[model samples]
Target: MRIRKKIWNNDAEPIIAIMVVLMVLGTINVFSSSFVLGTTDYENPYHFLRRHVLVMLAGLVLFFAFRKINYRRWRPLQGPLMLAVIGATFLSLVGVLVIGTEVNGAKRWLFGAQPAELAKLVSLMLAASTLSARIKRGKANSLFNVCNMKYGLIVVMAVLIELEPDMGTAAIVLGVPVIMAVVAGMSFKYVLGLGGFLALLILILVNVQPYRMARLKVWFDPWADAQGMGYQTVQSLSTIGSGGFWGMGLGEGVSKYEYLPEAHTDFAFAIFSQEHGYMGAFLVFLLLALLVLFCVRIANRAPDEFGQMLATGIMVLIAGQAIANIMMVGGLLPVVGVPLPFISYGGSSLMVSMVAMGMLLNICDHGRNAGGEFPKGEAKVTKSKDNKVHLKLVK
Candidate 1:
């Protein structure tokens, strides 16, 4: 078995195909979803369509860049990750307070030196990389050890994200790494036990906040608060149901004509369904499903644990967020302001999604180029100082 020295190793077909389809669908959906608002708010009709094109182009470049990079050297990145995640997330939160731009009562940046949207991918990478190294270092007591430095950093990232009060992104930032943890040799018992505790904390967090609690209530019966908290849900469901099977046709939907707020952002899925109908919605689901399947295949083919875990983390981020957004529109869950993955009209979110995909492509390449199983000594299991089983990092 030969270990290759260069990158660009994986077949780029899966990553490329998934991204191309997403960009096409997202472009179509964004134009249709944003039309009414864009025209009424701006003089030119193609305002958002043009912007989406630019963002997509930039994201494509970044994705291809990730495809070319190596995934194995992240081990030395351990110490700097904490500082990086903290500095970046805080700067975004603070920028929204200081010189940062505000969009909808919440502080997030659009055009600036720092992009908060990028934090999703950045924080996940930092979290994933940190744990992969430690697990390799023989920390697999895997239970109590989960509470130490590995999870500690993740908790800090979650805290900062919660402070941003952007619960949607915070959920994802935490959730993706948790998936990676499970893949990186976490115990089923502890994972399930911790999952239960986290769910309880989420319930308490949602109820403790008056708005979150209100949203939950409205989710159950939006008609009850149609004039207040339930207004969005009521309108969303109406739009969704109004579409029925075949939809009203592109740019012909009544809801986007000022009936539904946020027709392009949080509620974009509703608009997409209203225009494309159940068929369109199903196609969206199919596209997303294919994306995940190929990504999983890539993960399975990964050359190393770092590559596999990183790919898994990206898949979870995209698929999880997409489901959250779509379910919110379906009235199956409370509205959480999560953007539909590739289809949302925001640059930061779209660009970051592609970048994460790019990282996965890199991992795939590493896997393909990697060529063989563990070198003789590499597979030997070792016990840590505390008698926990752990694997050694590939040199």
Candidate 2:
């Protein structure tokens, strides 16, 4: 008997390494960006730093816990998970509207955490479970039914998050699932139709909110309102521009002192760019892009449909948020309050993202254990009369 050489190494190593680097760097960035805010707001320079450390600890706990659980287990508990996630999300959104803390005109927090952040993970799970189940059952061929089955819960969650006026997260919660559905074999016709509808809805939502419209205006002309509505954008651009090709130096950027609002949260990328330069920012982007690529590889080798969709959904969740944060900070897109994955200082976002990464790692482990081929079989590539290649699984 001959043994086959391994064609790929373990996928978890690079991912875990990237994650650790980001967390350490994120801690440093948070300290630098939030020092002034911490001192002025709470009279303690370490206020945000301490909270960030605690959050990082919490996220690590979740990451390790989820890593031990098998990705396939999520299949059997999909129904219950959906119900619990929806119930929690609905209650949280309602609670925010009624009594949750309102900061900067948005009521997006409850019990000291952002429920909308958790909503992104839960909605992704539900979407993955639904789409994968349909694909396995041969129901994915019907666009209408697939949309109804997979999208109902996602639409509900998106609407609630949008109402929270956290449009950044809402777009992610909605967008990730759509990407998963498309990957799971939803027809392009239905995708375009729904895409158009969602775009129009977003337009309406933007037009109705004065702040959102103001953001749009700033996107087009940041200098026009440099001192008012465009202050954040102009400040962010100036910080990056000041950094040149390489950043000023770690902990040396002055924009975080008072110029850029939300420097530690929505605009952390700008702070990072200022301190580390465009080269550092590019490295971060490269890391995230590699993360997504590894995720796609895992999805291809997932032991089952559930694992495939789950991995894909996780990739979308992280990559989508990363792109949004980078684009907004670079002034290529309007500011949308999206945090950079693994590098932003929000407890809920960090925790949820870590949990999602844990699941992705689990899938990678499972795929490796399955010999890097799903369904516990060998795949033979064959060409048909039409000259198209076909994959046949052999026992």
Candidate 3:
């Protein structure tokens, strides 16, 4: 009874449904990928599946609880949230510098308790809040007058993220606000100019870092040095290709048996493609597309600019990670080390992704609430007393 209430109590059914589908797919696929990885440790190969269940439970709890609270409550948390995340990202970067943990020759952590991920969500919200306030004050349409107040704050946050050397995430974080600014009615000329400048900055960043250049070179053709920086991409392609149409069959993949590096983390998509085959890979992509479409729909129906921006930021967050992960796996882009959102085996990424989904659901809930109220013991709804009806007759 209690479980039913928790699961069915939301007005955000469409958003919740998308998350549920992803969680289910992720859980099944991870089992398919990790059973063999865990077989040596436990008699049952479903060890990771058990852990996945626990993680999903924790995530669902957060989902329901977060749904009850208004997201506006996060407004006051913006400054402190940014500070805390920046501190954590810096600590992780410096921690890697001091006692760095190396995986596949990269300093990114396997246990990314790093605040960078959390910062992505906070930074998005902060940017949304900052920009939304301007729009509400009717300054959004004003040329040379918008984005002046909190622009400093946004830049400082971006610089701190870039300082961590997490260019992929920093790029997405910065890009989102720019999108929000444009959507909020910032002038097109300004957006075009800002985008050009951002591109130049990225070029400089790539020029300055030898490894970044190497990754890009390998992205163009990993075969150039298959045994060097090109190694992972080559392995990823081989693994993905080996899967063919139906895949070699789950737990039967040759790659996760140690052929592919980062098999359980950042490059887990390669493992997935190997086990599930093209059909499986296509299904995963389809679900992701559906998830993206649903999030955008929710954003379109959002009651206010804050809600719209929040929904949009979260959608971009998921879509960005998906595109980056897929491109890396497919050998179309450098391995920027962004994990596959729901499908990757992770702690911080999993929970935070769930939180972002929760926020998305919260946005939908408000839309549904405004639309109608559920009648007791019935799924259909009627107008609530608290809300004034605004109707337009058919013209």
Candidate 4:
């Protein structure tokens, strides 16, 4: 593998700036939102703030570490890395069921971290490596061959996460890989069939679980049971509405004083809106949009199919979760335990997001350095006389 002399360049500057701004804003909002909860629960007003800062520091370390390392280094270790992540995820998911900490009647956390969070990055990596190899070998021409072990691993992980009863995260774990596969050139018919199956599965899951069904109802009308099942949504809407245009001015919002649940994690954006109002909320959205745009740009410019797939997967992962969290908080969608990326106060989530961004930045750097020639085994698509798509390796 060739190493670049300069790690910092204009190509990576915008993303770095975005990540820094989000992290700083996240630190401030986390403190503002969690001070009361920290005081009441831990007898220390700064308890959550302290933990948030510590996690931020750890995440920064990972961000820089991944940024400095070559993204292609992982290709050689894909098999071992995939197997290790699968084993760890399996154990963590099962162990959480047996001995995991239960919060809000859900056992999604084991040893103070969510294994489902880590699974997202690993699954994407596995998909990129598997799909790139298939493209290089001309094996991606068939849907059956393309949906290989990597897809199986993704489905198994999704099932385990669903068993953790975290449907939102499960959807992400399952959905993002399929998106990468589509980018890798899976047939639209296959995608449509998979979509129907997932929709049916979601319907079944919701109907089978009374709580999910109730959430769907509350999503339609939170005021129906404002003090019972719809309490969080009601409070969230009120909190956001109170912000008006200019907001209540940071630290002055009243919702975080026990009115809204998970104020610093799942509903952190609501608290942000309450404090900074419409303008602040818009700014955050714009930043997230820019981040996604830049990642897509990186994917388009990546030197090889593998790098392109990796960047595309990361882009989808971040954008999807951010959209879900914001919509859920605004009552536009049914509330799920999805957190705002980078801005939510969760160690596992923040760490994974930062590391993913680091990998993305590394890909951007590679794109900048690769002038014309690409790495060996670069996959190119060709169409035969019979109108069949084929991959030609440009070694």
Question: Each candidate: what lDDT?
Answer: 0.73, 0.82, 0.72, 0.85
* TM-score per model over all chains: 0.84, 0.90, 0.80, 0.89
Candidate 4 displacement at residue 141 in angstroms: 6.5
The better candidate by lDDT, 1 or 3, is 1
Candidate 2 versus the native: TM-score? 0.90
Report backbone clashes per prediction: 3, 1, 0, 0
- lDDT rank, highest first? 4, 2, 1, 3
lDDT of 1 by residue, 206-280 (tens): 976688888877788899989999988889999999988999898778898889888887898898889889998
Residue 121, candidate 2: how far off, in angstroms?
0.9
Superposition error at 9 for model 1 (Å): 12
In candidate 3, the residue pairs with backbone N, CA or C atoms under 3 Å apart (3 or more residues apart, or in different chains) clash, namely none
The deviation in Å at residue 76 for candidate 3 is: 4.6
lDDT of 3 by residue, 1-395 (tens): 45323443444665567677777777877776777667866777888888878877887887777777666665533556545755665465456544555554545452545545666776677767776666556666444433454555556555655665677877776677677677778777777777788889989999887889888877788899999999889999999999899988867888777667777777788888888889989988988898888788777766666777788888888988899899988988888868888888776678888988888877776653523442233222123475322222211
RMSD after CA superposition, every candidate: 5.3, 3.6, 6.7, 4.7
Per-residue lDDT of 106 in model 2: 85
lDDT, candidate 3, residue 189?
79
Q: TM-score of model 4 relative to the true fold?
A: 0.89
